[model samples]
Target: AQTVTQSQPEMSVQEAETVTLSCTYDTSENNYYLFWYKQPPSRQMILVIRQEAYKQQNATENRFSVNFQKAAKSFSLKISDSQLGDTAMYFCAFMKTFMESSGDKLTFGTGTRLAVRP
Candidate 1:
């Protein structure tokens, strides 16, 4: 069984500041993938960052980055110079690399509501 957990239910940061969202997961699978998704007011889930279990290096994109700890089963997202547009609901997701069937899907956490204050 696999489960994702986001400890922070809500977080606020001033614009241009940096904020780190905490996430942890429990999984028995050796090969898997972790992802951070952002869902804005439009209610569309967008992929922010992704980390492969086998990769030692953390994943980063622009101002968005992730601190992936494979051994500790933790994957946290760090947003630098946060902008107002970054305000959204962040979700942590997990997916097994080996899919037994087409029905395989990702397991998501409760989510963290991030408000980028002006």
Candidate 2:
């Protein structure tokens, strides 16, 4: 079974500052996918970024980036130039590769609530 662990339960960052949230996982599969999702007060799960296990380079989107350590089974997210609107509950998810004929479901971590203070 694959499981994600978030050490921080809550984090606060000043507006315009940068923050990194920690996440680590345990998986025996060699091929899989990792994802970071953000859920604002609206309760909608939004994909922040994704990384393929086979990719050595980390993935970045705008001000968001990831530090992916495959051997260590660690994947962390870095948010730069943060804003109040960025405040949300961030979740780390893992998904196994599914066959073309099969369906897949996402497994999520407990989540870390981020507060961007103005």
Candidate 3:
């Protein structure tokens, strides 16, 4: 099993600014995928960005981007042009490329609470 860690528990950012959340993981698996998920006040989960272990390119979705360092097992989420609506709990998750008997399951970090202030 892999374990993800988010060092910062809480952070506040001004609207229209930028913020970065740090994440690191310990894993022995070779083929895997890393992801960042956002959960707002309503509890709806959203996929921020995804990075593949085999791919060297970082993944970005809109204002959300990830800085993935495979060798260091580090994956950080960077929000550009942050908005008030971006306030939420951000989780760093990991998944293996292949499915296991129990099905593909995601191992998640404790999470970082992001509050965007107007």
Candidate 4:
């Protein structure tokens, strides 16, 4: 089993700026990986990024990026040029490598509530 932790329960960032949310995880297995998810007021959880354990390079998507330190078991998300629409509850999640049909066991962190201020 894997466990993810988000240290900050709440964070605020100004619009058009940058913000990074910190996350840490514990796992005994080596093949499992990490993911960042964003849930807005609409109550939909969106996949922000994915990082495989063996990958040396961090995963990135548009304005979102991750600082993945496999040695330290840390994965943090960096949001560049933040926007009002980015205000949401961000979660750090973990999943073991499994067949897509078998179903994924995702362990989610408590989540960090982020607010994008104007």
Candidate 5:
């Protein structure tokens, strides 16, 4: 069984500042993909970043990056130069690497509601 945990229920960051959201997970599978998804008021969840368990380098996007500590089973998101558009509920998710006949499903954390203020 695999599980994702987000300790903080809510977080706040000022515009132009940076914020790091914490996430932890438990999984026995060696090959997997970790992701951070953001859901705004519209309820559409958007992919923020993704990290592969076997990859040593962390994944990053324009303003989003992940600090993946595979040994510790930790994957956290760092948002740089936060903006109001970044305000959303962020979820941590995990999915095992696809196999021909595998029935793996995504396991998600409770989520952290982030507010970017002016």
Candidate 6:
């Protein structure tokens, strides 16, 4: 079974600062996908960023970037120029590519609560 571990239960950052959240996973499959999701107070799960196992290059989206280490099975998220709006519960998810006929379901971590202080 693939499992994601987020050592940090809670974190806080000042507005306009940068914060990096750590995530590690264990998966036997050679090809899989990793993702970082942010859930705000509204309780909507939003995709922060994603990385394909086959791709050595990390993925970045605006202020969010990932440090993907395939060999170590680690995927970390870096939030730059953070704001009060960035405060939320961040979850790291793992997905294995099943047959096209199969359903798509995401396996998520326990999540890290991020509090951005003004």
What TM-score does each of the candidates earn? 0.95, 0.97, 0.94, 0.95, 0.96, 0.96
Q: Tell me the RMSD of model 1 versus the true structure.
A: 1.3
> Model 6 segments beyond 4 Å from truth?
none
Indicate the residue-level lDDT of 45 in model 4: 98
Error of 4 at 30 (Å): 0.9
Name the 10 consecutive residues with the lowest summed lDDT in model 3: 96-105
Candidate lDDT values, in order: 0.94, 0.95, 0.92, 0.94, 0.95, 0.93
In candidate 1, how many Å is residue 92 off? 0.4
Candidate 5: residue pairs that collide: none
Tens digits of per-residue lDDT, candidate 4, 1-118, equal 6788999999999999999999999998787779999999999999999999988999999999999998899999999999999999999999987676896879999999999999
Worst 10 residues of 5 by lDDT: 97-106
lDDT-wise, the better of 4 and 6 is: 4
| Pairs of colliding residues, candidate 6 | none
Considering lDDT, which of the candidate structures 2 and 3 is the better prediction for this target? 2
Collision count for each candidate, in order: 0, 0, 0, 0, 0, 0
Runs in model 1 lying further than 4 Å from the true structure: 99-103
Q: Kindly list the per-residue Cα lDDT of model 2 for residues 1-118, writing each as its tens digit.
A: 8889999999999999999999999988998999999999999999999999998999999999999999999999999999999999999999888679996788899999999999
Give per-residue lDDT, candidate 3, residue 17.
96
16-104: candidate 5 lDDT, tens digit per residue: 99999999999889999999999999999998888988899999999999999998999999999999999999999999997898767
For residue 77, model 1's alpha carbon misses the true position, in angstroms, by 0.1
Against the hidden true structure, what lDDT does model 1 obtain? 0.94
Model 2, 95: alpha-carbon shift in Å?
A: 0.6
